[model samples]
Target: MGWVTGVMVYFVVWWTVLFAVLPFGVVPEEAAERESGGWRGTPRSPAIVTKALWTTVVATAVWLVIWYLVNSDWLSFRTGWLAMPA
Candidate 1:
């Protein structure tokens, strides 16, 4: 894959990884009041820094794999799924 394609693939992979890593290690806050629980919109500790770090690492690895597949002759993305059988 070219530099531009690699970068684009990495960008998409980064965002995908971010969403996947966002829910890891999430903790819900306990409510003090018995009648009505205070369940806020945000998580107890979002851990943005940790999540971002993991996302970067995961995205890099995923991008490398995809880049290799596209550049290598082992796989061909141009092959059509609907092609008629010989």
Candidate 2:
């Protein structure tokens, strides 16, 4: 993929991975805190920095795999059974 396309793909992959990683190692807020006055179901510690770092690592790996597939002949939509009629 070209530089622009690769960047766009990575951006999408990063956001998708972020949502998937957001709930990891989460701790629910205390019952007292929930009853007092606050948003319901808030995590005690969201750990945004840690999650963002992990998202970057995972997204890079995923994007690399996609880049390989698209650049290599191992998998292609324009050939074999995946080809479309002109």
Cα shift from native, residue 56, model 2 (Å): 0.3
The regions of model 2 sitting more than 4 angstroms off are 32-37, 78-86
Q: Tens-digit lDDT track for model 2 on 1-86?
A: 89999999999999999999999999877553545765656787899999999999999999999999888766767764556766
Clashing pairs in 1: none
Give the winner by TM-score.
2
The TM-score of candidate 2 is 0.79
lDDT of 2 at 18: 99
Give the per-residue lDDT of model 1 (tens digit) for 1-86.
78998888899999999999998999876553435645654477889999999999999999889987777656754554443445
Superposing all C-alpha atoms, what RMSD in Å does each candidate have to the true structure?
4.9, 3.1
